[model samples]
Target: MQTFACQCGATLFFGNRKCVACGCDAGWCDVCRRMTAVSSDGHCLGPGCGAAVAPCGNRLAYDVCNAFVPQSATGETIRCRSCQLTSVAPDAGDPQNVHRWRLLEAAKRRLLYDFQTVGYPDAQLTAAPPLTFRFLADTPEKHVITGHADGVITINLAEADPVHRETARQQFGEPQRTLIGHMRHETGHFIWMREIEGQREDQSASVFGDHANPAYGDAMKTYYDHGPAADWPARFISKYASSHPWEDFAESFAFYLDMRSVLDTLRCQAPQLVGAGAGDLPTMLKSFQEAGVALNEVNRSLGLTDLVPEVVPPAVVAKLQFVHDLFQRYVAAT
Candidate 1:
């Protein structure tokens, strides 16, 4: 969530198509990875930067993406790195789908940016794990389910509709849910495939139970038939997390990313609170709780949902710590 400087000395934001103060056009430059002023013809006009870039097809056609594709890659790559990761996009013919797709892409952009800031590889690393997305809507013959498999993350288009999403939240008894939360949770599975599945079985089992046992399908059926354990709050981050070990990991990973986002914003905007950045899970969680109290209070005052939960169970914290350490290693190696 770091702000970028425009050539006109105005602050530019990530999704901004034009700088409000300077009236200069702004775009996300692939070279600098920042929102910077761009000329009408697609030359990056940022300070000391003149990389030739092309607007993503989604940007030029749908006004959905604000990023650019490298000019040299125009032949083979018509989309920006973030937009490129999407293998399937919602149909634009439907007016509702257009709005829903726009919101979905917006969330995906923020998710990818969070990954970039947190030191996770997106388009930068050839060795990085495969991660792609599909934004599909339910049809007469097909039910679009949201989940991840073999590096592909499928997000149901309805999630972008606030009414549909809020209904799901109440039905599932979830404290909070959003498009970005869905991205983080599903990417959690993608990361587990690359980093945890075969790489650190022992450590993962120690943190979250053996995912191999009980068979995921059987476990899922049992969970649906007979809700989560009554004492799940003691050991899991969410009731749904108690369904299976894999779910626990994803929930923990998603929450870890959420905390990281919060702490990173704090470090940037309120340096006094963050002090040394999000150091470790323990430190980060402590800072989040301290800030969450105020955040939750503010939401309460405004009659909005709480930004953070009232509790972070010790067991869930351990799982988050494991995830934190795992990614920290990647950061250090990078």
Candidate 2:
């Protein structure tokens, strides 16, 4: 992510809640899409962005968000776009839940920022049903499954507990798992609903196979009955992606998002890599591969988990290309 400059001439980060250099209250200003400093009287101090602003309700109530909503004429505090999409928030009475809620909002804001930059509607988190997050803890009578159904992306609160998430990641043999990953993966389903479900079934099914052939429930049951094939690396982006065609698409979409994020960071932090066609898929992937090797080796030297995957299979590249093209069309049509 690109860093912003505080009015104090200090670097400001995306999620920073205050300017450390000048003790000014700070929050992300949606109008300017900048790390904004605001005066005590609610006037935004972002360059060329002097609108009135107020803290998001969650920021005021639980200190979970570092975002501002346009100040209401009635002087009522409101949720920011990201906070508004949270249909079911974690219980705030519990201290741990409050912390977990903060983590969730931070991740959500990152995902929304990426979406906006990439030309997706979720950036605004404008409505419900088609896209929303339901963060629920498991109850004695109910288990919160982390998946998308009818556009609602339900997350198990336990995923915010690093220990629990790590244990589950190891159990499933996943390459990586985090709150942001979940958001990207789940939104992949929403993308399917928007871009492919009824409009281009033949084209999508030709690439990923028919999503409804065996039925999702049947496919999921069979996947658990027998693990992924040994040759899955050649055909699928992840082991879980082998469960069904829809899953394959979601996994590939998630990978594409992840790849784009890495490439963006590289471009911002190391501008020397920018060349003609720098934003093109193949060019970006080639650059990422070269950088990934160095990044992976550096992580090894530090005895840390590899920061990037070693390779992207040709099959997965095709899937990524599909995702890229879909968004290109999405952006153009808009």
Candidate 3:
């Protein structure tokens, strides 16, 4: 992530609420995708305000909100745009909700930051229909489930627990798992709706296969009953992807994120890997492969399987090239 500087030229993190050098209060505007300063006395949560928006109720009582809301707000409580993506929020009345909500918020903001940094301009947190987050209480009477629907993402509050999350990682057989990973994986489902639009979706269908064919409910039932398909690793990035087409899309999206982030990290940690070139995806892919090898060697020295997997077969690499070409064409057409 890039660091932001205040008007006075003092460096600040992207999420800084106040600029220490200039003593200016700052928050991110989803619309502008930049930091905006708020007046010292009070700030507006209005539509145009660039401040990182949150729930007004949290602000009034807790005085800890950094969310921006619409100027036309006329309700008992106002929710921020990002918060609206959540369909399940922990009970505000419950004190434990505060800590759990904070954890989800941090991960969600990070996901948004990464999304915006990439080419997806339409990604934003809004309060209109509201992107809601529900942290479900873990109780025997209730079955906690986490997923996204419409604009909402539901996360089981138990996932925030170290033991619970670790257990899930083992159960799912995922090499890497974290709250951020969960958010990234789920957001993939949300963005897939945007990616597979128009005829391109049909073309994507040819590659990823038809998503509409399955009795989705039945497929999910069979998946949970019998587990992911055998030989899943040969074809899929993760076992879960073998469960359904939608899941494959999400897994592929998550791998795309992993690629971008790992590439960025290499650019910083090993400039030699990037070399002296700005190239298209094929060229970038070659450079990235070299970087990946170097990174893997380093990991091996440290006794770790490369956190960045080298699973792109020759055919998969070509598919990645196709995606890169598609992205370039998209930018040109837009």
Candidate 4:
């Protein structure tokens, strides 16, 4: 993410609610994609704010969102663009649920920011099969599965807890697992349904296998029962990706986002070292490999594991290129 500065000249991060230097309230401007100071009269001084602004209803009610809504927003309850996409939120009455929900929202906002940065179509709740979220608390009797259906994505609130998520990562033997990763992966499923399913089946199948395969379900079941093939690393980005064609596509999509995000962050911090704008797939992947090496070294110095544990083989690189081509097509169409 790009660095943000408060009106007071103090550095402000994405999740900052108030400027430490000026003690002024801060809210994120979706149009500007930055955190800006909120005036005493509740007007945001950000570039896109021509009218007064108010904290999103979710922020005012539960202190869970830092996004802003223009005062001119119509409706009985005004929500920020991000919050508007949430169809179901976890219970706020429980303190633990509230905290976990906040973590989920934070990750979700970052995911949406990346989507906007990459020029994806805006997710509107009013659209047919609108993009939406359901943050559910898994009960002892019924387990909640985090996945996407139609345009709606469901996340288990337990994933928001670091310890719980770490335990799951160990259980699944995944190299990387985080709330943001989950959001990115699930959003891939949504994008496939909305953008790729019927429009470019031939092109998608060329890289990700046939979506019409009759043994798709059985393949997924067997994958879960036994595990990925020994040569999975030669083609798939992750073990889970080897489960089925759909999963391979989603995994590659998520990896594409991850690489883009890291490269963007590097460009912002060291423009001299890395050029601006998305470069070609090979160039970007090469830069990511170099950066990952440096990042892993730093992590090792700090007594931590590798910053990025996944390896990108030639086959995975081809799949990522396909994902990039699809994104470019969507951007050009829009």
Give per-residue CA lDDT, model 1, range 258-333, as digits (tens). 8888877778777776658557667778888988888899899999999997488787778888888877886998
lDDT of 2 by residue, 227-276 (tens): 89778888888898889999989988888887777776667777665443
lDDT of 3 by residue, 144-227 (tens): 778877656678887777788878888877776778777877777665554554446777666666777786687788889999
- Computed on alpha carbons, the lDDT of every model, listed in order, comes to 0.84, 0.83, 0.63, 0.84
Give the root-mean-square deviation of each candidate in angstroms.
2.0, 1.8, 5.0, 1.9
Candidate 4 whole-model C-alpha lDDT, 0 to 1: 0.84
Q: Kindly report which residue stretches of model 2 are placed more than 4 angstroms away from their true locations once superposed.
A: 122-128, 273-278
lDDT of 4 by residue, 121-145 (tens): 7643246798899999998898999
In candidate 4, stretches whose alpha carbon ends up further than 4 angstroms from where it belongs are 48-50, 73-76, 123-126
- Steric collisions counted per model: 0, 0, 26, 0
* Residue pairs with backbone overlap in model 2: none
Where does candidate 1 clash, by residue pair? none
